[model samples]
Target: MWSGDELDLDAYLERIGLRENPLAPGELRADLATLYAVHRAHTAAITFESLDVLLGRPVALDVKSIEGKLVHGRRGGYCYEQNSLLAAALERIGFEVTGRGARNRTRGDSLLAVTHAVLVVTVDGEEWLCDAGFGHQGPREPVPLGRPGADVEQGKWTYRIREEEDGVLALCLLRGDTWRDLYAFSPQRYHPVDYVVLNHYSSGHPHSSFVGRVIVQRPGDDVRRALVGRELTSLHPDGRIERRLVGPDEILTVLDREFGLRLPDREAEELVGMYLAGD
Candidate 1:
């Protein structure tokens, strides 16, 4: 039996706004279209956030808690939690999914923490890279792995990828005339135990920004919305930017309205207080 029995697959899909499975029960195919649909729905419905870490609570990466937090609890999480939830759902729907880690060059140019997580999904002998935890600047949909595309801004910021030496692939962000490296990873799969260690450092270590800050993001077709502490930003595809400062009292309101999350009032207050406390 699929591990999905531990989670309400129907409810999880519903939570992600997929009212009904486009592919039938036994007819589900692990094709690019299906991957794209699920990837898009997940990024749109479930947010990429670090609320639990900011609250100093242990972030759970197990399938059960990941499903519970995103589905019934109406919560969001960072890389480990978000991708775990997506991996579970995809596996239940007949996809061959393997967890992979990226050296998060976006945060720092070091590989000390292989922090970012992405799923390597095989469909018809081709591996597709799928990620739902990359907050605002991640791929808007599943992209073909190894055979990276360039200047492909389909409801996402401009990004490109290239094959690197030693069997690793590098994903980059197009910044003006320069392409800045965002992350690098090989196709080697990761186990759940690896995430446990990384999650500890990401949520507890003093140098990790996730520990003491408020960060939440959800991506859309025309724009991206994110909250870093009191600041709210709306990034448009047409080179337009909109920014605002959200007050502490209204943090919960913004999270719910813009990010599609409804955390408890008390927990919301605590997270906001920690963010306002500053480093």
Candidate 2:
């Protein structure tokens, strides 16, 4: 339900790291394909993290803050915040978009208790899956839901989509003849509150990964991530894994130099101290 006044094409494009806005549905010579391509490239370069929360600056789950944190700053954002804002943008651009509930297929078989939000867009009689909040790098390009073997790029990850029973779709990564399930989602329209509840659990739950640890991931030609108290791992396009041991102080340096993330003086020191103390 995005109106013209709320849809600022320039700001949206800039937030996603596009130099110029691409043609969207019903626009001048709109090309949904290229638009999808551009978005995918842009999203891969950024990451999604709860660094703000861990740093004691929790952002409210609202439109303006979501737009500023996710799009304006061009930083990584969680599902509800990222997808909701993107959906609003697509709507303004004249795309027939719908919000869908998604489940962490990697977690297990659970259908009723969905935990993620994704977008399905129909342009020129084709359905494309648009997910911008999956991670630092996920499929930014729209995936054709009808094809048998469709691959989309998200950073260095190649997401392959295949058909499943009951008209559901299974999305996996093609790695050495193996398809790893990242998640599965249906094109069911979800309400705003549906996302709010999930977002709360993801951000606040004690056992949730975000609440317990610090993580920052960026999908490059080589994907890299730093997990607190764990070895830093980098996944190359050729399937080679590079690992490094990071210390407490190194974390702060990496955060500033590598991720472009700046922490408050005291907060940065505390994060270092916490890891050093193994607390």
Candidate 3:
């Protein structure tokens, strides 16, 4: 429950590379331009990570703790923390934002639980689907929820919104010649406790990907950077790709140098060592 005062708007704006303005949400147009700038700036600024879960660090989604870790401490988080922070920042700017949880259909199983958070932002009666938390395959701009089949291109990547007969909307990314589902979401708003439940499962469950490996990602100039366990991938604009496996000794170096995350040296060493050993 963000009361709008929990997040320091000035600190948040500076962290996300936006200038602080006294304009209220009503004062600024919720048009595509404003949405795009904010969305891009945010995705560009923060890394999508789950290192705390690996290190047994208590992850809290409350506004105060979120500000301390992400905005102030300069660490990153997974879906819940990322979206919660994004929503708070949006509310501060006067965007009519609602927190919604979605099933990750990217793995091709519709039976998956609601583990991802997204925002349905309304401005001037028009609603757009926004999720800056989706790591490498996420949209850099908002997807107009009204327009199905519309494609959003970032560099060489193409994304679209697929609406099913049951009224569920799935964000899809084109992979090679096929369209891959990113996630399935609905219009229903979710409460804060819902995320607490999902976050617990995501962070603690042995079957969850977060617990199984070390995942880190951050947006680059025209590339999207992602590190899965020891594999680091750099997806480029023209579809050319570069891939490398980081050695055990260089785990923290890769995380810090590439992802801009500076976990304590001892913790980074132990967490990565533990993860590899467990795997």
Q: After superposition, how far is residue 267 of candidate 2 from its true place, in Å?
A: 5.3
For candidate 1, write residues 1-279 as lDDT tens digits. 225556677787788777676653455456777778778888888888998887878887778878778888878889888887888888888788888788877656556557778788888998877888888767778767756655555544676777888788877766445666777888787877777888888889998878667899887777788898778998675546689988767777898889878888789778667656653
Q: Rank the candidates by TM-score, best first.
A: 3, 1, 2
The all-Cα superposition gives candidate 3 an RMSD in Å to the true structure of: 2.8
Give lDDT tens digits, candidate 2, residues 172-234: 765545567767776567766677778777777666656756777655556545444446666
User: In model 2, how large is the Cα lDDT of residue 220?
Assistant: 52
lDDT against the true structure, per candidate, is 0.77, 0.64, 0.80
Candidate 3 lDDT tens digits, 199-238: 9999899888888577898766578789987789997655
Choose 2 or 3, whichever is better by lDDT.
3
RMSD of 2: 3.6
TM-score of each: 0.89, 0.81, 0.89
Best by lDDT: 3
Worst 10 residues of 2 by lDDT: 21-30
Model 2 lDDT on a 0 to 1 scale: 0.64
- The per-residue C-alpha lDDT of model 1 at residue 151 equals 54
- Which of 2 and 3 is the better model by TM-score? 3
Q: Which ten residues in a row have the lowest lDDT in candidate 1?
A: 21-30
